[model samples]
Target: MTTSLAPDPAPDPGLDPAPDPALARELRRERAHHDACRAALARMAEDVAEQVVTGEDVAASGADAEVLGRHLRSRAKEFGEQPPGPLFFGRLDREDGQSHHIGRRRIAEHPAEPPLVVDWRAPVSRAYYQAGAHDPQGVVRRRRFGWAPYSAGDTADLTGLEDEHLVSGEDVVSAIVAGEIERPRVGPMRDIAATIQPEQDDLVRSGPGTSVCVQGAPGTGKTAVGLHRAAYLLYTHPQRVRRSGLLVLGPNRTFLSYISEVLPALGETGIRQSTLDEEIARHEVRAVDGEAAARVKHDVRMAEVLRRALYARVALPDGELALADGPLRLRLPAEVLAGIVAAVREEAPPYATGRERVRARVVRALQLRAERRAGPLGGAWARRVERARPVSAFVDACWPRTTPEEVLAAVLADPDDPLLTAGERAAIRWAKPPRSFRSARWSAADLVLLDEVAGLIERPESYGHVVVDEAQDLSPMQCRAISRRADFGALTVLGDLAQGTTPWAARDWREQLAHLGKPEAEIVPLTTGYRVPAAIVDLANRLLPELGLGADVPAGVSLRRDGEVRLCRVADVATGVVEAVKGALAREGSVGVIAADEHVGPLTSALEAGGLLRAGGDGGAGGAEATGGTADVVAPESAGERLSVLPARMAKGLEYDHVVVAEPAAIVAAEPRGLHRLYVVLTRAVSRLDVVHGEPLPDYLAS
Candidate 1:
């Protein structure tokens, strides 16, 4: 376990050296180590599969044998598949002279042999990411390995290595971070395990019990940090987290797809990734709401209004509860029944639970009345009395059954309902009530209300941890919906307050935390920009004053300053976007042409008609494209067209090497928080930002 401060020796003098002998030797050793780890992992997989096969025999003898067999077979298949990626990315040298290789997963040899690769979440591997000159934490040097493009039937090439002397006070700035940030964008997002900065690493390694709110600017690696934190918690607290589960919630489906691979690349799987709407609705939604209606639905005041409306269904029975059995008859006076309903109401349980309590109370009263009259009546008589039609009818009338949808429909259908006050009624009433529950159309924001009501009726299942990205866009009730899912667990809230782009978007982090039921959670700000360059960030910051973020505006510093921000006034936006996409496609990485939602159709058509863009099926299609009126092109990485026409609203938490923003003014005019939306679009580029506007830019950007 002896560690070496000295670099690896040069290649043998007699052998022909490839480029740099020391680097070549290191790569060769690392490759051999990778091969060993792969062999060990194969053996581990074989052992796991064998265990599953053995368990199948035992499970076959049981009544639920088929169910158990299916689960085992699925697990065996997971163990058998070898995902492509580097075996390890870093090596940490501890103060006790121990060296540990850090990778996406753990790998070990026989009991006699030491572990070949330690999981990145291991405590000893923390130095690989957090160790620095300021706080070496008992580390001498840290090494980072670089990988070549992955090819079929082979693991990624371990081509290069970078070293940092944590205790030597040596400058750490090198090609390692710059190269990672500048790496060509292909397919979904890759893990930042090898390039995680100290600040990001701090958040990733936070304690499991500590909830955190990361206020990170674009390119600060907030999403990556959040995902990695989930992986870390799963690895460190496997039993606790596995039992409660973990989830990563994003702003939209496209955003979810964009970051889908990050967790798996870090050797974590089965972690649920969902959009807020998907998580809330849990089913297909065919309805759409206008901006005004959506805003009212998302308002925080709706919580109080909905609460009153749901409880309004509860009422005391007007008559007595009378139960008759063969030779025995029991009568509970109306006042007694009223008292029982009052007791349950005083506890204020869920509306559904309250109904159950009232039914139980009625049965108890019948039993007591029968026993007093007959001097300990037989069990048969009590059972028959409880099942009497009169008792059932009374309970049904006192507390009628209802669903979340039914309650919501009733409230919206009646403007003068007693549950709604003057202001609440004005804010939530539908323009035209549906004729029936089957005809009512529910909007995305309405789904949050449904979720709220559902939770009030029956407590929702909670998770071990919840990582919410693009949190600034979540309305108060939406936050509450998410909060309910992690009542006993911690949360990792990630977003840029200045990037809030919804009508009911939060004005401050404090307000958002309060709504999420984690007001005491620590708020950490990450201002450094690693993905988007400084030049582009500066240009985006100009819109912050208009956003009214005040002191919370993030100051971003990029690792590389070689990025361009071009603002051009064009006669036609569609033509300008097409030209911009063509120029960006000619570059090395992925390109995105972001425009207002209404403009996506025209731009998509323009690109398709010009034959500059091809349609991609995997991208979540909406608006005109969903109905097949126009093609919304979003070419998959393998399609060889590294370009996508993205709606501006879907642009948050996504980064492209080159970005073309069409009509900033139009983006601003599309919603009440258009200025904030424009800011988000302006900062989506990693290498370059091209602004193409037919109309004048927003006032802040214009100046």
Candidate 2:
């Protein structure tokens, strides 16, 4: 069943070499399969669009008919909106006949027939990623197809095929695998369904109920793994996921945009991707925190401090409560009221629930008193007793209504708290306090504290699954916010400790996972470089000790052999950067020109002066502009625009074919964890890394 292609013919003296007959013939067969699958997918979309919901069964109910029609239309839209690419990317041949071909989304010709293309996320496709010459997993051969620019099954789109004979125990690496891995990364991050490695596949297929934490180094494909896990959960547990929801938390909007296309490319749509600040925002961020103030707010102890401040609002009733019961007034002593409050507080329910429980207990006591006085009472009497003004007033005064902003404001302004010293409180307190909670100008750190209060006030709604990337930089308080949403469900935590650049960045995954409410979650380490080359990874490893990664483990090892590392010194940093970017632009794939935060402006001007990085004069910056203010994202992802100029911090989660880093010392001096930030910058190059500096490079990076 394996169709092997003949080797290419050797070239004659000055004549063009003839195409291999077997290669040409196999390409034809693959194209025919692609066209057939494309046509069947179109037909499936048409069938959904043509569906008729009969009204006869529900003639009296237009609502039922409208709902059914909307559902059909939604299905039609989903089918039509599937990303246009090769229908199938890989195929597995087995004697037991487990699969026909593996694709992004399944395609079938008929409702009851076996699919023409099995979804890559399907259980049967594991062999494509995991099977090898040593462990074939029941597969005899595996084939990968190479695709050209997408054009609805064009004549040349399906161009080449390569295969591995598992039964022969041949260990040669396939040329197609290498080509796909080293392919140019031009647009938004694409789905790696075609190049997923065995280790990554294990993480991607982690069970729906299992929480996992991935400590992936640069170019380890953790981001793609997290996204694919979301898609996998959506497919495996559609109803549960749809009922509760699925969410992905990234470090910034720029990261969110760079990965926005990944899920959709994998046939998943409408997933809620957001940053932690966006999720926990209670007010507009009109204030900023200094380093010390931010560290105080992000401390894990802040969770308990906020909880105490919120509960401090609750107090015992000062006096007796008089209840009018069936024309007879009843008086409950303050001692009884205090007892009820104590009993409910002892239960330790949510703040709001505690209030409700106390009120209910008071109502019950009043009912029992009424029943004793009049033998037996109806439910109507209890209702009147519950609605009494005296009862409402008593409960309101004891356990008052409040908001997250109110609690946070009170805690910040209160100088008497032991948790915060005099100077600490003064540092965090509003220098010019707002008129009230409504007009309060909250900082990003303040929003995280507010989320803590909100969680205590009432448990935040739970999601079926959550994927938090760049988790190493999340402070303890931020992890609490994510934990609140996934309290009852699972998580896919992804990050690297060496990439932690925040003042309060995590030093260990165990402590961070504890804050995420998944202390026992399995921790998986991925240090193999897939997208990045070995030279760049080796260059980054020099900073590992400075980043706190111990020497016991290998820093990282890239599987790629072809990569370039160049360190150049020049008299002018800006001019040197311009030349480096220009040189990189002449090569294939996207280029990223990164510099220190303060240096981005000068570099931007230089790039524009050199006739590069043109935004069409305010027409728009496209993807770069849409990334918001997370970083100084400069260049747009426009036509013929292969270069993205950004600050060092913004390069944390992004990769390019060739990267240009300007002034290594400046990047290392920009912040407290500048070395970690520099480590992140240097490892972003997939093929080549050019470090251009006017000053001497960081000691760690200097050879």
TM-scores for the candidates: 0.87, 0.92
In model 2, the clashing pairs are none
- Decoy 1 TM-score against native: 0.87
In candidate 1, which residue ranges exceed 4 Å CA deviation? 1-20, 59-75, 111-113, 150-156, 282-287, 325-328, 368-386, 417-435, 570-579, 597-611, 614-639, 694-703
C-alpha RMSD of candidate 1: 5.1
Which lDDT tens digits does candidate 2 get at residues 1-703? 2222233231111111234677668668877888888899889877876773332345545887787776676676677678777788899998686656999998999979999999998889888899999998889878877655333445355556777889898666666667677776666677889889999999999998999999888888989999998999999899899789999998888778778888888888888999988898777898889877898899888887888888888899989999765577788889999999988888889999988888888988887887787778777777777778998898888888888989988877663567877777777776776678788878889999998998998998999999999999999999999999998899999998888899988888898999999999999989898888888998999888776667423477889887999999999999998888778767766777788988888887888888766643321112232321122223333345466677787787877888888898999899989888988899888889999998877676777
What are the runs in model 2 whose C-alpha is more than 4 Å off? 1-19, 52-67, 97-99, 149-155, 551-554, 615-639
Q: 564-662 in candidate 1: lDDT tens per residue?
A: 988989998898888887777666676778888888888888988777655543332211112122233443322454666778877776777888888
lDDT of 1 at 473: 83
lDDT of 2 at 533: 88
